[model samples]
Target: MRELAKVQGCLDRARGGLGAVLVVSGEAGIGKSRLLREAARHASDSGFAVHVGAAEQMTQTRPFGPWLDALEITPSSRDEDLRSVAVLLRAAILASAGELGSATHVVIEDLVDLVERLAAEVPRMIVIEDLQWADDATVLTARAVARSAAHLRVLLVVSHRTGGLPAIGRRLRRELLDLDVATDLPLAELDHAAAQGLAEELAGDAMWPAVHPQVEAARGNPLLIELLVAAGGRSGEGDLRCALREHVRDRTWALGDDGIRTLQYAALLGQRFSPDLLAEVLGRPPVEVASALQRAIEQQLLISSGHDLAFRHDLIRDTLGEELPQAVRASMHATIGRTLARTGARSPEIARHAALGAPRGDREALELLRRAAVEYRRLAPAVTVDLLTRAESLADERLPDQVELELLWALAATGRTGSCIERAERRLQDQPQPATAAAVHACLGLIRQRTNDLDGARTEFDTAVALAAEAGQIPAAYLADAAST
Candidate 1:
């Protein structure tokens, strides 16, 4: 709101003689678009004409897609008069000036060059959204235009997510500093009253009954608020899944079977995946995968992060995951695991999926799970717990009891020390097997050591070492360390 006031001040100054540039940024789903829409509405009421355009996430490589969105021009027209259209837009701005309805106000949601060019032509307010996702070319063009034509009577506003900004955005910030027309907008979180008001906007008088939990779940993502409210009280988890699937299907239906296959391959890898990995797993060329990903991005179902791609929503991932038969999902998981392993990825996430989804209880699956458990112990404790829990649930009697003990040991190795120790002690009490009891005591001893209870640690270590000795196995070094301490 402060930035808007400053921009409006610039616009007001432009009526006499001045220019402005506003740089606003926040995290993804942080209401950049919603806020821009509201600002555009205000501009319109204040007598400025508004035109909005957005850049597609998947087509950063494609030039002028965002410009075309704002202009609503077809491919045929774009080819015929690209520069001529710019001149025409310039003429429109000049002709639109002076009269109350004469000046044009434009919001180019994701492109900066398109607005920068138009700003050079006339006195107008121009807004650009999501400059972070912009291609290098767009960034370069916008910077050049902004630098060369700062004297123009225009107010330029641009917004983006603060994290994951490409290098171009950082450079632009430094460049804009030289212009002395920059205004940074920092967003504040919605307070309780404001959050309730937003919910009421979506659900009417009884909004809280439907919107409170989603508001909590969304944690202030405005786009998520829309999806959650539309999904209706969150009971439509399945419906939301189907809706996302249909959204993707409708957008990609025009592409032939190859495109559909590419999407299915990506879906099998799950959400937030690398396009390069998906290409490898599917045995398709990278170019082919890139093309399919581009098309999906144009349709807005897939969002891009450099070389990686992901479904725009968790619902989309769930939808695609559920569509495949159990056998197919298992097969794909196995294939992905093997491909990742061969490429030296060392990704525990892939291994966990393979262990849980692969139908064949091959030894590879077990090794993958064990390795995943070890890696997750350091990088992600909850994931380590999940991997071990899955492996234990699926392991057959053919598995050695020691393997089960190892899984339990991993679980206790990476978690809230108190919780894991309590669970381990309870489980050991039931089984009372020497290997399991020793593993449980070893874990408890480690937890006690971490908490600085040397006396308790020594007692648990003594019990573990005695049990291990009775079972004809050496106690682990960690237990020995606790004992010495």
Candidate 2:
């Protein structure tokens, strides 16, 4: 509101013929574009003329692109005489966009001259957005108009991300900061209280407490907060992934394959990572990893904090991870697991990578999975179940094995008796060897006993002992023991 009020004051002064420029700067998703809309609305309500324009990455080659867009300037006839062209600012820009695309000093003066005339007739506010993508001429025109603000009755508002700025664009930002008439508005990320207010506003009173937990996860960025809320359910997750993938891809288009691979590896490590660790994971020299990280920083995809690097937003990390192919993702995680284990990372972290990276039916992987389940079973039963389920899938051809038994026990402990019962029944129906069938029957009998169905429990227990005895070479005694009270 204070920034909006400052804009309100700028409009008031412009109406009184002492115009000023308002320069808004922030990181992407920090609400630069939204603030510009609020200021435009405020200007419109006060009876000031409002014109809005945007600079786009695709249109950077067109000099004065923002100005031409602001005025909707286009020549109706290319054959118009010099007399007609000189009298019309629209013709001047159309011509400048054609041959003088670099936008010389003469072109800058013409825009100042035109803005002065427009504001003289009616107090006008022109808003230019995405100034980081603006051509050199656009930056020059802003500086020139700001310099002539004492005479013109127009408030020029320009907004851009503070990072990834080209050299010429930096000049305009610096000069505006020095100018007395230019008000610098730098938007920082919202504090916790402010973020909660915004979240409550989005979710309403009913969801205030519900959204509290995710506010910190949003990292004080507004767009991420909204996305985190929108992405709550199973189906919304797919939609959110698609939306974020496209948005992040647009921002990361300039990044090379090495930079993208670095980001993916970084995502595997978590949001913030040590370069040396990342280097070990990638199997690259430390200097090569550093160069890739530096490129990511320059593109504003990552921010460097001392020796470690972090994604500028978690959404970037998520989208990049989502884009990796399943095979590729698993291979990378496999490498990550080995690397983390070599570096003496925690058992849980390595276990997670091992579970994610393991190939099918590998006994070593089964051992790792078993160890991980043991470590997590008492601490996090759900995590134990998920880890065992992954191991079970990998060992599909070797059903009724130790991993499957551990998964069944884990499920039963978590009160998923029905799921475990159903799984055992499906395995029995597959008609495996007699010993395997006995194991399945033993599992079912245990579930029946737990559920207090004594008659049903005996029926399953009798079948298990019979199946084990039918195999002849296997002992019925162990199966009987498994089915005992």
Candidate 3:
């Protein structure tokens, strides 16, 4: 929320032309309001007349609730009579800055229509906060108004959480394509030094050591940090489960199914996930998924990194994971793995899910491990080593002989290349199946010959030639010529 550079940049842009729409998005309690409050102060100091309107969840459905609140109006009277209140609200804004007949800056906090209407009058900085819970009507109206403010000296700044407000964000972006500026501020996790400093700032010196892990665990989210500090002043975990549960419960009811699904799937992915992968996992269209992702990014539930995205707080992922049934999670993982496989892409992540989702004796599990081993062999050398290690551990004793040889091939191609000679030699010693053993020795011979192990290479080649004669295969004969070098 306190991305000073972004706020200042918007201010500068607004000063030059029709106001700028600065969308401040992050997760809940990420200091969105605090940042706006500071920007308001800065705007005031710079001699810009500023009026603020904040959008609260309760009054989102009622048109201009935050706008009405900012002006200290009770809409109870208007609701009873069904009177048009737009004129009155406009009059009030004009009275605040217009009556003075001076260069005024209007800061409309929550709703966009009020800001859009005021844009016609003068240079203004309109800040709409808590947009994640904004009413659909309010969002649509704001989007229309935001688009019209291009020629006016108005800076529209809206803040919402990324996960909670997908539908509204989607509508807003499609309708107001040109004027919208989306800014995602992923709060930086506190480093040791910063954690100690924050601890000292909130609680005195002695508390730093006690609270370091909690701060680290919270991932330096200012809102979470403040909440944790206020709860116990740098003590123990201090009801992390209770706090997290309450946090989710507080926000979940307001968001629709898309929000819930995005959060749950992201939780399964650990912290960060690829956008394409997330879309595939959800089985949603790219545009729709992207819109949801952008909304989540804006709300602070997720952050973007080039093409990948992640949860704003690690605790969010942890909490969602803990709350779900194991079976449900396994099902989701299976969907994710199959989706990835269809695209001809493989990941350790997919393997993990496939491993968990497939039944113990299931052929799908066997195939997933085999595919994972081969893919790991092709893509990630270090990761292949880890996956192969896990696969070998889980592999049944009755695994086919060829499967064992494939595992050896993967091992040789990955981190344990030094063990290749021993492994291949042992497999050959066991079966001495000429052509197959020759193939293994041929690979070993190539590697040995490359490393200048001439004697070892000679022995491997001689064995391969003898195997070629015994096997009487055209392929083995060719391999014999290649291995004999």
Candidate 4:
């Protein structure tokens, strides 16, 4: 609602002979398009001439597709200058052959000039939706139009997803960002109360307690919520996944095979992935990956996010993951993990994929999981638990005794002291090496501290210190200091 007010303000500014550009940006299905439609209706009611066009994924390869769809110049213009510019633009589009560079320049120039001339006659509003999918030439022409109409009575409105744009789309977004005369309107998902209200309205009298889970799962995405409501609130978790998959399929049906394959691989690499990483995973060239990404962006299946591509929605990624067969999914994950490991990616990222894809008792996966657990120990103790648990699952006689001790320590850090104590006591009963015994005592001490048993903690710490000192290990000093603290 506040965003609509902002667009209305931009429209009011345009009425005063000052042209403006308004960029409506958000993730897919978050209401950017709906906001533009509302702006168009308001412009029409205010006696402003409005023209609307949407960029299509299927047509993005065609040059100047969005511009050709949005503008219509009739020869009945009263102004001679307007008519001349319009004629030139039409001629350029209809041209059979010409110098490519020269013809493109002329088309861009005339299109901007034509819009300025028309605006001088009457206030005008132009709305282009899904600008992220617009062809490069169309985006360039739109930029030219925005610059030329800056001081005229024209309002330029464009909507795009916040990220996952091609290079040219990114350039257009940068140009808009630098515009002093433009307004940036970013939309966010509705809050729970607003989402509930919308769901109730959509569900009518069919609203039920069962609908709450669907709403929660939608996570404020209006389109997903609408779909759930349309299903008469019968959506369970599996139903929700299917619904999201169908939603993504409907949008991506026009993508070619290459684009679909690119998406499938990208999904495996997670919601955000780089072209280089995807290329490595698919064993394709970077150029091929870039082209496929471009097609996917044009189709609105992905958006450009900085140096990476992100799914238009997290649900889309989940949906894709759900659709993959178990074996294929595991294979892709294994390949991705190996690639990430080769590229020296972060331990946690590599471990996550490896844990899912690598065979049980895989030494490499086990080591990566343990290292990842250490990495997450302080930053996210719960994550440490998960990683260590995975490592424990893979651990065998091949794994060193210290790894099991490390897992118990990690579990203790997460306040699972009872489990840690039990595991440590059982291991200690086996008369392990001095260092191993010290580690067990240290782990139990930490758990005792967590449970407010200071005396017990001190006793364990003292025993740990004596064992480590007897082994001539520096860890005793650290354990002694830990108990003092």
- What is the TM-score of each predicted model, taking all chains together? 0.50, 0.66, 0.56, 0.60
Best by TM-score: 2
Candidate 1 segments exceeding 4 Å error:
1-3, 47-54, 57-122, 132-141, 148-150, 161-170, 186-197, 204-207, 233-235, 242-355, 360-485
Per-residue lDDT of model 4, residues 207-265, tens digit only? 65657666776678798788777665564566666677788886667666667767887
lDDT of 3 by residue, 1-485 (tens): 34788777777766676466776665577666777889888776755557666677566555555445443445444442112354454555467653412211222333344454554455577666776666554465466557656766677666766455556665674454454443444444456677657755875566655655567766656767765665555334656566766776565544467777777887887687887777777878778788666655654566777778887678777777777788888777777777767776656766777766655555665677666766665566556556655565656654455555555555555536577677776777778567777667766766667688899877877776677677885545445434343
Best lDDT goes to which candidate? 4
Off by over 4 Å in 4: 73-99, 232-242, 250-314, 325-327, 330-485
Error of 1 at 91 (Å): 19
Looking at candidate 4, the ten consecutive residues that score lowest on lDDT are 476-485
Off by over 4 Å in 2: 77-103, 205-212, 231-238, 254-258, 279-301, 313-315, 338-355, 361-485
Could you give the C-alpha RMSD of every candidate to the true structure, in order shown?
A: 11.7, 8.4, 10.2, 8.4
Please, what is the whole-model Cα lDDT of each candidate in the order they appear? 0.63, 0.76, 0.63, 0.78
* Residue 144 local lDDT, model 1: 55
Clashes of each: 3, 0, 19, 6
Query: Per-residue lDDT for 189-256 in model 1, tens only?
Result: 56666665676688666545765665665445565566666666456566555555565565566445
The true-versus-predicted C-alpha distance at residue 103 of model 2, in Å, is 5.2
What's the ranking of the predictions by TM-score, best on top? 2, 4, 3, 1
